[model samples]
Target: MFRFFLLSIVCLITIPGFAQFPESKPEDEPFLDIGVALRFNYNLSTWKEDQLERGGDFGFDIFRINVLAAYKGIKLNAEYRHYAEGFGGGMLKQGWFQYDFSEASQIQVGLNQVPFGIQQYNSNNWFFNMTYYVGFEDDHDMGIKYIRDTGRWKWQAAYYKSAEDLVFSAAEGSPDRYSYDILGRNKENNQLDFKVVRRLGDSLAHELGISTQGGLLYNLDTEENGTRYAGAIHYEYKTGHSLWNIKLQAMFYRINPEYAPGNNLNFVEMGAYGANYNVANKGEIYTAGIAYHIPLETRLLQGITLYNNYGYYNKRVSGFENSHMNVLGALWTAGPMYIYTDAAFGYNQPWLGPEWENAFTAGTPGDTDWHMRFNINLGYYF
Candidate 1:
């Protein structure tokens, strides 16, 4: 199934004359735009413990296919993704249609991203970090949302299903009664989002956003329901030669643990703060990163990008005390192409036992505890 969809997209982009599609002019063209991007990365590694060893050559990954089209009163947009190794497998990230009813109001319907967090609104290329924060998964639900613009103050409202999956049930009384069949249901997970922004002065601006969602769930053994909520606030400042932005976000959920049957979890949460600065013509970018695990009460540098960067992560947290990491790399961009390289060394500090001494390492086996990565990306706009 995934393979078929992947092939269809390839054909759509590669067929002869596909590029000749009507191009709108600046003066006479409607407000529509389309673009695509391709990105790839490779890595080398060395490890201190058997548990941390895994490396080899990876294939090019199709980052995304972004499409934007809008007419006088209607708008359409979509994005898709393709993974490495799965040449014929891909997934639809977004597909939506929107309508503008005057300069102040608009409505959108289809499978689209939920407008709940600052990261969702900021373009991927615009962020200082290339990776998403913990708990910030990229999954969109089918739904509808409305937007209204009132000068510097804009607002949005959204409602969507929480889950989009099929459950299998056993057929009643038959030799193959134990066999299960797939069933689909529209769980009532819904969300509401609101936002407002205003410029404080010539070089300062602030924005506030709030979002909430709730819905039903089906437990494997029995039917169940639950609710989840998330909220975020952001502040941005830009001057002739400096820029600063900060955001705080949180999420809460009430549910049951699949493995720990009969154990109902009340809350699980995570938070992160990041800031970056570009010194006027210093020929480099500087960034600071930090994240807190409410569930584990642990914190770390996360990363820093000066010119270029290299960093490490625990990948997973169990009874681990302190995870190790290293950062060494830089980035350069020209025209529509960007290139970057980084290497790092990581050591795991266990809360108990022999500390796993150098539990994780990268780059060279003994020379330097770091692994090197090279990334090259090219994108075009129309």
Candidate 2:
């Protein structure tokens, strides 16, 4: 049987996909498939500031457990992951129950992906674009989502009660997660999202979409609610003959938060990957990326993709230094085995910069410098 997201790079910003990968649909009888994946990586990071560590290079990254079940029009999907110490021990990436309205429409209820920025992902590299850090790209929450796909257009609408509740709390969500979310002294609630994309062409497809999202940030300290909103315009060009994909996106976001006395409104705490850090209250992001899929069919090598993603964050805060990131990488797929090789460069990015506490919050603006990391990750699935 063909796997839904098995080893697919499009699952990077993984969701219990919405009947998008391949032409998958619920079969006549009850069916279940369970798979496990092991991943390891080698990295030479500048931020480590250690020659020996950089030279050592090789380490275990993470492992994943995934499940898919379907009966008639009802479907189920879930994935859990375990990472090395200090990053996040283990977490549920996503879990959702889906109901297909027809071949053209469906709904997902449970912990589902929030429709924003770009579909699946905006970047093809191992490390996604900078937007993933600030809870814009590939984010998930506790919600219900409706999706409709026409030959030429796709529409998505969702309402999230809040971010994923790790410890069953309403106040704060743990940061040990694959996708970013709002947390800390405030909680994200009553969030709504709408997105529509238009696809033009067959062999050479031009896709454009607009997305808008808004929510209330409930402050536990003051027992009141604040507001945050974002809007984005995204475009992509894919050519079957050339096997080239081009993507571009522009976004503007602002968080009008009401905090307790003495709290700064310029930046707020956003959490992910087992940590919480300051994120700028307002910013505009511009991103571009390109990928070429090489159709080389072989026993050992099934596919190859070369890509580069670049993002620039223009902070609205005065005198705050802007952020820049570029990831150039190649992906190789062979059956259930996949590999990625990347060289990532950044300035003021938490994952790439020296200071991690306030990189996105722009709290420590001038203290950051250029950093780079060379990484190779390999994954095998059963």
Candidate 3:
């Protein structure tokens, strides 16, 4: 099955006229383009009583299909994702339309990916892999957003519905009602982001960004009727052949007493797969990282690049320990394809660990541990 899909993808790229859209010869005519990517991975560790579990493998980890059409002042865009799991497992990730009001402003409406950060929209950008806060989740709720870009300033605001029911309260022995007050409201949650970039010289530039989200409601096994708020700042600078970026974010939340009384346990489960304990309280996290890139000038790999990054996160409320991550990688562009590889190391202090022994230990679930992953991908743009 994997081989057949792989061959089909290769043929689509090699076969001319596969992109059946008409060419855009006139400025007023609508235009269309397509993009595809194929990825694979092999695990090095196996699950066992004394070793980490392995045996997870995938081919064409992601198959993306994009369509863009524009005519007059209206624009339409759609994207689909097909995983190796099969056709039924595929999903319509993004479909949206936008109307241009002027050179500096536009309004977009549809079921589209929210634009909360640069990482949220462009995870495939070469620089994204080098950062710890890449916002890898592409979750999109039905919504609309407005964006304004003028000179050095840019901003965007969006409102979306919660993807699931809002739980008001819960505990190991008790249950509560699921709130549906905002079920039909388009603005169940709101997000705002802004940034300003300035050029200091021919070889130097800088940018600052602010992002915030609120009005999120969630009901869990321990907490009921919870609310979440977050704020983040990002800074970047570029000089010569090197670039640098840093990000800091913090969050506060409220939950029913059945969980805890403060903000510590909100959104800290590592993408939705962590154990739930009703220790309600407030929590704050501070994270920062830096990345450097070097471009090779050789004729065979002129676009080759190297990157490295390290990030640290601290939580103040949930008994959760502080964690850190380090990553290094490289990319080489070969004609219409690019080759890339990355390795990451992470460590954390468990609540029971000594001050100097916070680094994660092997052979324990939810314990501090380290892992390394590598990937080789082929991507094309039209």
Candidate 4:
């Protein structure tokens, strides 16, 4: 059934309109662009206890294809992804339609990018930051969004039915990659996000935003609500063959869940198969990162970029030590392909430690705390 449904969408997206209803100028008739990407990676983790796997391992990462089209003032975007699990049972990562009102304003509807945090984030590494793990980054949802960009100030606002819903809904308790509000008898009540960005100068900018969400979890017999506020500052400079970018951001988020005394457990962090998810509270996350790009003259080397990111999460729960993560990485690009390598180390305090899958899960309070992992990603985009 899933395969048939996926094929149906392919047919709808690929087939041309059989009936013409209107005409447009040459520049507005229609245009389509498509691209594909294949990614492979190698991973090594110090927390892995498997003796036979102490060396390392490599495997196929993911395959993705995207389509973009525009006609008159309407635009369409969609993406399909296939992963190792379930083999060919593909998934629709994103699909949306946008309407342009002017050169500086537009509105999008459907499954669109959620305007929160620093959209793409400031990390050069692929794993990104912890906020991403908690649903504040690279997340999209069914919504309507309005975006405006003048010269000095930019504005974005969105209204979503829930944090998520898909063309194909997952079975109950099925593991998902992105986090969402847990619904009781229905989807998350509703979510809204608003942000404003100001250009400080030619090379600097700043942004401030807020997000509000509420829902219920009948299975857990709880009601959940959260509000998040964040701010970010960014700067970029380019000279000769060198380019540099720096970014810093901080966020404070709080979740309130209705609960009975002594029964205060609610899932968070998009529960994994064998992980705990009882920790949720007011917390602040701070991240700072810098990247330097170097131009290359060699035929096989297009450019090189070096970056490092530092992130700290402070939980509001008493006696919970702060979590810290640091990453340093580099990317080498050649034509349509790029190779990325990075080393990441972090500690997840006691309260949140057990929610993870690494050595942190085994550590007791007051233990020397840290875990490390190295990763390499190679991908081609065409």
Instruction: Score each candidate by Cα lDDT.
Output: 0.37, 0.82, 0.42, 0.58
For model 1, what is the C-alpha lDDT against the true structure? Answer: 0.37
Pitting candidate 1 against candidate 4, the one with the higher TM-score is 4
lDDT of 1 by residue, 1-382 (tens): 1111111111111011111113232322454444566666554444323423544444574556666655545667776656553332455656789776766887889876665544342211212231122222233556887877775666677776432222224211111101111112212244444545554654344555444444443333344444333344434332233323333333332322121355323212111111111100001111222221111122422222233221223222232222333334433333344444444333331111122222321112334322322333332222
Each prediction's total of clashing residue pairs, residues at least 3 apart in sequence or on different chains, is 11, 3, 24, 2
Query: Which 10-residue window in model 2 sums to the lowest lDDT?
Result: 12-21
Query: Clash number for model 1?
Result: 11
Which scores better on lDDT, 3 or 4? 4
Model 4 alpha-carbon drift over 4 Å, by segment: 1-28, 51-54, 86-89, 166-173, 178-187, 203-242, 260-262, 265-279, 349-364
TM-scores for every predicted model: 0.55, 0.91, 0.63, 0.78
Which scores greater on TM-score, model 1 or model 2? 2
Cα shift from native, residue 199, model 2 (Å): 0.8
- What C-alpha lDDT does candidate 4 achieve relative to the native structure? 0.58
* Residue lDDT tens for model 2, 67-92: 77776567888888899867878988
Better of 2 and 4 by TM-score: 2
lDDT of 2 at 336: 68
Residue-level lDDT tens digits of model 3 in 100-208: 7877788878775554433342222222321223122244545787888774666778776533222332312111111112221111333333333333445545555
Q: Assess the local accuracy of residue 369 in candidate 2 as a C-alpha lDDT between 0 and 100.
A: 75
